[model samples]
Target chain A: MKRTASPSFAIYTPDSSLRQPLRLVGAMFRDLSSGRELAWRLAVRDISAQYRQAALGLLWAFALPVANALIWLFANASGVVLIRDTEMPYPNYVFTGTMLWAIFLEAANAPLQLTTAAKPMLAKINFPREAIIVSGIYQTLFNAAIKVVVLLPALLFLGVQPSGYLFLLPVAVMTLVFAGTAVGLFLTPVGLLYTDIGKTFPLAMQFMMYLTPVVFPIPAQGIAATIFRINPVTPLIQTARAWLTGSLGTDLVAFGLVNLGTVLVLFLMWVIYRAAMPILIEKMSAS
Target chain B: MSDPLIKVENVSKKFCRSLKRSLWYGMQDLGSELLGRRHGDNSQLRTDEFWAVRDVNFELGRGECLGLIGRNGAGKTTLLRMLNGLIKPDTGRIEMRGRVGALIALGAGFNPVLTGRENVYINAAVLGLTKAETGRHFDEIVAFAELEAAIDSPVQTYSSGMTVRLGFAIATTLQPEILILDEVLAVGDANFRHKCYHRINKLMTDAAVILVSHNMDAIAQTASSLALMDGGAMTVFHEPVEGIAAYHDANAQRQATTSDGGTTHQCYAPVVAAEVRILPAEVGYQGQLTVEAEITCDADLPEILISFTATNAYEQAVMCWHSSRHPSPLGLCKGRQLLRFSVAPLLLDNGSYHWNFKITRRGSLEHVVWLTRHGPLVVKSRHRTLGNIPYLPDASQCEHRMLTSP
Candidate 1:
C-alpha cells in the first residue's frame, strides 16, 4: 500500500456568482461544444444505421429532393389541363428552393430534438454542450452535400448552363445551414426546460413554412414580402434559385447582406444557448 | 499543501411545486399571510418552495469514501449530484478537485437498438472515458458482466437481469477519481452482489465513493463516515452503524406517532399495514429445542401464510418448509398485532439459512400483504442433525430410475 499525497484544504473561493443566466449560458456552451464531439461519435452510429441495410444505399439522401422536384414537375404539367398556369418551368423553380430548404430543414431540425437526448451524456460525463448541436449540424451538412451533388446532374439534364451566379450557391447554402442551426441551438434551453418547445416544434415549423419564401414568389415592391425577406432563409433560397436558373436577381447585394446578417443572429443565439445550456442542464439532471 | 479533493459549503437546494402542496398553506395567503410572504414568484412557492438545506458544509479529503445515509427524498442524491456538478444549488457552491465520475443513471445511455459493445463505448465516452481507454477496459468489463460472447448482441435481446448487469459493469469500470453512486448496486444475485461489494471496496483505494442506498446493512458494511440527511439538512453524520441507528430511530419514531390512514401510501389489494412484529416464541418451553426468527412485517386483516426453511451456507435447502396458514376472514383486525414463529426440535444440519417471510391471502393464496427476509440462521446441528429430522409418512415409498444398461 502506498500513500501518494496528503490532503491539503485550500480556501480558494470560486467565482461562481456570475449573473445566473450568463453563468447558465456559459455552461450551456461548454456542454454543447463538448457534447458536440460526443454527439459526433453517436451520429456516426446514427448515420450508418440509417443507411446500412437500405436497398438504395446513399441514394436515400437525394431521394427526397428528387421526389420533390418531380412533384413540382408533375404539378406544373397538370396545371395547363386544370386551367391553372405557370410561365417558367416550375420543376426548376422548386428544385432551386428544395436544395436550400432541404439543408435548412435538416440542420434546424436535428438540434431541435433530444435536448433530453443528450441527458445521458450530460449526466454521465462533463463535456461542451455544442458537441451535440454541432453533431446535428454535421449530419445535416452530410445530407446537404448529397443534395448539392444531386443538383449538378439535374442541372445538366435540364439543359441549364452554369451562370456566374452559380458560384453564389455555396455561400447562400452556408447561411441557411448556419442560421437554421442557430435557431435550433437557441431553442435548446427552452426545449430542455419545458419540453413543450420540443413537442410543439413541428407545429411551429409548419407555421414558419408559410413565412419563408419557399413555395411562392415575393415581389420586390411588396411590404409584406420584404418582411419575409428578413427571414434568414429568404435570401438563401432566393440566391440558390437565381444561381441554378442562370438568372440573377436585382437584389444580390441585399441577399448576400441578409445571408451575412444571419451569422450575427446565429452567433448571438449561440452565446445565449451556450450561457443558458449548463444551468438548465444542471436543473434537468438534478435528482 | 495539497488541496482536498472536494469542497461543498453551505449548499442548499429546494424544489417548488405548483400551488398544489396543501389546503393549509393557503391560509397563509390572507392579510396575516401577507406580512409573512415574500414578493412575486416566492409566493408562488408556498411553504413547499423552501425545503431548507441551509448552511450545510463539508469537504472531502482525497481518497475519502464519504457515506450519505438518508430517508427517501432526504437530499442525499441531490447532494451527490451537486458534488458531481450535475446540479448547482441555488445558494452556496461545490467544487470538485478532480475529474468527477458519477453514476446518476446506470442504464441511461444504453440504446436498445445498439449492441452491448457499442453501448459500452458510448456510455463510457459519456462517463469521460476516451476511445482508447474504453478499448483497453472493454474486454475486462464484458468478462466481469459475464456477457463475453453476448456483447455482440443488441441490448434489447438481453433480459432485464442482463441489462442491469451490463449497466452495472459499464458504470463501475470507469476509473473515477470522485465516484458518486446512487442506489445502483442495489441489484444482482447474492454471489454477484458480494463480488460487486468487493469491487467497490477495491475502487475505494483511489476514488472516494459518495454512495446513497436504502440498504442500511450495506451502508454499515461499506461506509467509513455516514451523513444522515433529514428534511433537507444533515441531521446526523457519525459512525456508519450509529447513523443507521439514527435512521431506524427516526423511522420508528415516525411510525409510532402517526395515526392517519393517509400515511400508508404503498401497498397492494385491500390489506394495509396497521401493525408489525417480531417476537421470541415458546412461552411454554425454554431451551429444550432451538429455533429462532426475528420476524418483521405489516398487515391488517391479512390472511397470512408463513413459510420457513433451513439451509446450509450454500443456500441449498437441506429440509422442507414448516408453514402455518392464517384462516380466511381471519380473527385478525385493522390494529396492531404481534405474531411469533418459534417451535421445538431444531431440525437441520449445521450452517446458515435465511428465513424468507411472506404474507399472502390464504384463500386463493394469491393476494399478498407484505413480504420480507430475515436471518442467515446458523444451525450447529453437528450431533443434532439426525435427531432433528421429522418423521416422513413414507421414506421408502419413492422409486429411483436408472439410465444404465437395462
Candidate 2:
C-alpha cells in the first residue's frame, strides 16, 4: 500500500473536536469514579492484606490507639503533664483527639501513602490510581471505626463521663474524615508537580502529629497554638476530644464549619487534579 | 519548520539526576553537613549541574519509518524521548499533529503486581489505545504473545523475556498512526524477533514508524530512511542502505579519529582485511561470492594453521575451510600466502554476510590468535531467491530413493 504524508497548511482554528477528547476523558473518569463499590472492596482488601502478613496481626491495630493512649496515661501519671491535671485523664484526652483526627488522617494518608510505594503499580499496571488511593483510605477508616467502637466502653470505665456532646463527636469525625480525604485528593495531583512530595509525607505527618493534640492539648487562642492550628486538622482534633469528653461546648460547631470550608478547597483541587492527571501520566509513560 | 506530521525543531532534553548514593549513610552525612552549614563548605549546587542533549531537529511525515542510528551516549535516546514527549526538551520544541504511541522502553509501563490482563488494558490505554480499543485487541495480543495460560497471573512471575514479548505484542497490536519503537525488538530469541519485525513491517498500512535500534541490518531492512544522531546533532539523513553504509563509515572513522593514529592503516584493517566479493558465474559475471583465504608468513613465525569461515546475515556459518601445514621448504618469509577456495556464489541468496577468519598454532585449531568478522558482504542474486536454507540434503536423494543400496 502506498502510504503518503498529508501535506497541508492552514491557520489555526478552535477545535471543537478537541472537546470530544474531554468528553472521552470525562467518560474515562466516570468509568473510574463508577468503581465506588470496587474502591470500597479494594480498601477492605488492603486492610486485610496489611494485617494478614503480621504475626501480631490485628493486635497491632488495637495496640496503635491503645498503646498510644497508655503512653499518655503514663506520662500524665508522672503529673509533669499539663492538660490532664486541669481535669481529664490524659488517655481519654489523647484518645479523643486520636479518634477524631489522627485515625482519619492516618486513613487518608493511606490512599496517598504508598502513592510512592504503589508507584511501581501505577507506572506499570492498569489499575485505577484513584481506586488504589481510595482503597487504602477506606482500609484506614475501617481500622479507625473498629478502634473507636471497641474503645467506647473502656472510655467510660476510664472515668470519662459522657454528655450529649459525645453524640456530636460523629459529626466532628465525619468532617475530619472528608477533610483529610480532601488533603489526600490534593496531594496525589499536586504530587505530579514535584517528585519529592511522597518522600516528605511521613515527615509532614510527624510534624502534624505534634502540632495537633494527639499527644497533648494546646489551649485555644495562644499565638503558638494558633500556628499549630494552621492545619485545618487542629480544630477538628480539638473538637473530637471536646465532644468525646463533653468539652466541645460551642467550638464544635465552628470546627465542623472549618472542615466544610476545607472541603471547598478540596473541590478546587479536585478540578486541578482532574485536569493534570492524564497529562502527567502521559509524560511519565514516554520512552 | 515546514508542515510535518511530527516536527522536531531543535529539540533536546537533559535530565538532572542525583548520582545514586554509592555508600550507606552517604545522604545522612550530606544532610547533616548541609543543615549545620559548616564553614568553608562550598556546596554550590553540585547536585544541580546539567547533563544535556543539545539542539536536535528532525521531522517525520506520515507513513514514514525514520531510522535513528547512533553510538552509545550519542543522544539518540534523548531525541526519541523528546519526540515521544516522555520528557520535555531543555530547549526547542517538538510539535506533532496526531496521537503518538511510544513503545520506548519495553515493560516501562508494566506493573508486576497486576495480572497480565490488567496490565494489558492499562498499558494499552496509556499507549493511546482507548478502553474499548484495548478490549477489542486484547485477544489478538494474548494470542500473538502466546501467553494464554498465564494472562491472568501477575506479571512479576514472568521472565524478563516474557514481559518484553507481551509488551511488544500489546504495543504493536495498536497498529497506531505513529508507532515509536525504541530498541524493543532486541528482546526475545532470533526466531521470535524475526516474527515481530515481520509483523511490524506488515502493519505499515498507514502508520508512521520511528525505529531506534542497534542493529543496522534490521534498521536497513525495516526503516525507509535513516537519521544518524551524534553528540546532540543530526549527522546523516538518507535512505536505509546508504544510512547503514554511512553509519559503518562514521563508526569506523570515529574509532580511527579518537585513536592514536600510529598505523595510518591500522584503522583500515577491518575494511581491507580481505578482498571479497560474490557474483554470478554466467556471462563472465560472478554473482555469488565464495571466500577462500591464504595465509603466508615467515617460517620463523609460529607454526600455525589458517582456517576460514563464512557467516550469513544472521551470523550463522554456512561454509568453512581449513589450510594444513605449509611445506617447510616454500620459504614462508616475505612471500604472498594464498589460501584460495571459490564458490559459484550460489548458496548465499541475498542480504549482508560476514566472513570470519581464524589463525591458530600448528596442530591446535583452538589456539586462535586472530579472529575477525568481515561485515556487510551483500549477495546480489538474479535468477533465484532462496530464503534461509536450513538443510542441504544430497541432490541424489530425490531421484528414486526406493532402489537405493547400502
Candidate 1 off by > 4 Å:
A1-36, A52-69, A80-88, A120-125, A162-171, A243-252, A282-287, B19-48, B260-305, B308-321, B324-342, B345-365, B368-406
Index of the highest-TM-score prediction: 1
Cα lDDT listed for each candidate: 0.61, 0.58
Kindly report the docking quality category of candidate 1.
incorrect
Q: What CAPRI class is candidate 2?
A: incorrect
Model 2, runs deviating above 4 Å: A1-63, A74-92, A99-204, A219-231, A240-249, A252-287, B1-4, B14-52, B108-140, B152-154, B173-175, B190-195, B198-203, B235-238, B260-406
Candidate 2 chain A lowest-lDDT run of ten = A5-14
Tens-digit lDDT track for model 1 on A47-124?
765675577878988787678667666765777323122224565666766667778877777775745676756654
Which tens-of-lDDT digit does each residue in B202-246 have in candidate 2? 665566778888876668777877888776577546667787677
How high is each candidate's TM-score? 0.74, 0.62
